[model samples]
Target: MPPCASPLLLRRRLSTRPPHREHPKLAALLDVLNPPPPSSTPLPHALSSAFPSPSDAFPLRTLPRLLPRLPSPLLSLRFLLWRLTASTPQPSPHALSSLATSLPDLSSSVPLLLSSSPQPLPLQHYALLLNLSTHAGLFPASLAVLRHMRSFGLVPDAACFHHALRAAGSAADVSAVLEIMSGSGASPTVPVIVTAVHKLASAGNFESARRLIDKMPEFGCVPNAVVYTAMLDGMYNFGNLDGAVRLIEEMEGSGLGANCAPNVVTYTCLVKCLFGKGRVAEALGVLDRMAGRGVMPNRVFVQTLLEGVCMEQRVADTYNVVERVVGDRGMSSEQCYNVLLICLWRVGMTAEAEGLAQRMMKKGVQLSPLAGSSMVRELCVRKRSLDAYHWLGMMEENGVLCDSNVYGTLLLGLCEEGHLHEASALGRKVVEREIHIEASCAERLVELLKQYGDEELASHLLGLKQRPGGLSF
Candidate 1:
């Protein structure tokens, strides 16, 4: 037989017999040389010796074409039927074998299954799709799935609503979310609704949030403690201390009292707001009120109060609060100590600030950037330049990454002490190390040098070529 005729006979046999059981070695060799016929053909008994049954053989050849034509809806139905009837179902040896034969085509099967399902897909399946869509940022597809869910007469539970709300929030389509919620005929539980409200409030849509709160009762949904806390957070976030307080009063009138006392977060929000508005006394009163309500102040709340004291320049009071907070709870957090350090420095209590820093280091309290920077400033103010430099180095050694502001403080301190050469060296080091230097600090250093009658030093420090007169040095 001619070489070409042998291949044609082998192809005819493969077309008639099962592709899987064909002579594996010989067919592999044939595939490399004489290609199969363009159209399928029946095999004679003589060719059957080389190839097996048609069932397995044809799929291997026709799969590429059939796969492209395989309707998704049909595939989904097949899957559903298989799943429903798969009691005591063992693994399909044929399916696995087919998969191995065409591994690259497996992905295409997924869309086929999804498109073919006649009824609504299962919730779990939808959830998986939703997750994929969310990760891919396919909002329109997710929304379509949601609508598909409703069309199938399926009511979305809280978790589904929560995921949808999150998707909507991410998309920044609050109006679309509200429309979906209203049309769904499904009322979200307290947690889901509160999350929606909080999202709106955070976006500064307090009016809409308040309206939602009012409408909650109409929906036969009562606000839970979490909802109240969310409202308080929103009010505080919007800088409406009065409104937040009024909401607190409403909670009390409704016999809710402050039993919830709001969490540490709520208290911190209110305290920070009061401090921002310079109502330090009011802020302190809120702290007292929180304590009276048996809501123990956490580290954050204590830190906020300490910040208020610092802002008010109440050094003695700030120290007292710090000591009280630390002693009462045995919680000497770095934030609390940092606040104390700032307060001591502002009040010119240099020794006290230094003592506090030492105590913090001994207690193993990690110093925040601001706190470490403040300590450096205090040391420099007292002409403890070596100590300041040592602390900055220690900070770097400990993996405490200092920002541009900290470098500015260090440079300013060095310049103020007339260590122009050291300051210039450090500035150059900063540029080399790619440490950001604040523009304000740079300007301030130049101004200070001019005031000290050191025009040449200022020019050198600023990397300026021409020195100007009438600079008021």
Candidate 2:
């Protein structure tokens, strides 16, 4: 008998008799001797020799036998192997390659074992596979792992599903993710579904996004503030303002507050929709309603309203809104003044605009380039040429550098008003300071001189232009 068969012979005897023949005892012995060919060979001793001692070896040997007696020997063996190997210091590339080569059959059997096993895969393995699949962009392989997870009666938590969805979204393969969820009969929570909807909306697949929203209830999903906001933003972005408003109304009817009190996004979205439809009066009414319901308009909302008023040429109303925002503690001083100056300038109210600029100056609020430029243009438009000149002089004197465009505007305005002496002086100052004058501005100045019948001065300006280096005058 083979040396390994000694232990079995001590436990039972065998004889050379066919089991189907008349000798029943001999047949039993023959059956014991020949035990049908093993379904699989035992893993090599070297592989199993990962254990530190012989006492540790008994469990590996007796585990299959003890499985019926001890409930989870396979799990215990897996744990032991992982503890011994995976938790050690990081493996060298050669070690990893050797392990990979040695475990080819084991690797093939893992999926089969995982599929047939009643227990879920260990958390560590799942996490490792997830990270691998993400980096590799291996969607099909990831789906296989997730399928095995389900087969083992495991339910992934929200975070697991969220990460998987994010991976699929990154790969631009949303359908694969959908199929996995469908096959598992698992429904992602509101936030998970909203995240997917947002991705679809960004991809310009509004119809699919809407369909996903419609399917929310079937998955026992309810739209929270985030979900509602995502849907509203999607509809608004796609020019489905009416649909966005209807969703708001539906949210209200479902006992979600239509009042802007708890949900500023819904109210803001509605306000934007109103403005989009050119319903300025209705939009203002909505703002008032938002205010009454204690939904304080954020900077964005207030800015939108101010912009609408500017578009509609409602300067007085826009100014009122700006004042209201300035009165609020949270709004930035710079943004408030900037929008106010723009609205004032848009409606030809240079006087009011100048007042705003003076207020900002007194308060030590820094003006944005846009606000500064707008104020300067208003100064020139009102024929306050000296005011424009003084403002530019003050900016330079105070060491506040203005953009070249600001200087260009001032020079062009001075020339148009037949102030060639001042225009030439300013042009010389620009050239001396190395401030750039666009080619367009030079041409415009020449045109202005011809229009004013100052050909001699125009020729002088033309001569200055021909100089090799920029001239200030």
User: TM-scores for all candidates?
Assistant: 0.46, 0.42
- TM accuracy, model 2: 0.42
Which numbered prediction scores highest in TM-score against the true structure? 1
lDDT tens digits by residue: candidate 2, 1-473: 12233424523433322332222232322232234577252322323434344234332222222212211223323333343344444333343333323332333334444565566666656644444344444455456667777766676666556556655643256666676677777787887788777666655676777788778778886546667677677677667777777766666564654332236677777777788889888877765666655666676676677777777877788767766766754366677767667766866766667776777777777777676777676777777766788777655554556666677678888987767777777867865665655556767877887887767655544444421123333
Model 1 CA deviation exceeding 4 Å by range: 1-145, 151-154, 167-179, 202-222, 252-263, 307-317, 327-335, 338-355, 362-473
Candidate 1: C-alpha RMSD to true structure equals 19.6
- At residue 371, candidate 2 shows an lDDT of 66
Off by over 4 Å in 2: 1-209, 212-242, 249-269, 278-282, 285-299, 310-316, 358-366, 378-387, 394-401, 442-473
Error of 2 at 465 (Å): 12
Tell me the alpha-carbon RMSD of every candidate: 19.6, 25.1
lDDT of 1 by residue, 235-332 (tens): 67667778877766665454654443366666777787778788888887775676665567776677677767766767787767766666666356
User: Whole-model Cα lDDT per candidate?
Assistant: 0.60, 0.59
Task: Report how far residue 175 has shifted in candidate 2, in Å.
Answer: 14
lDDT for model 1 comes to 0.60
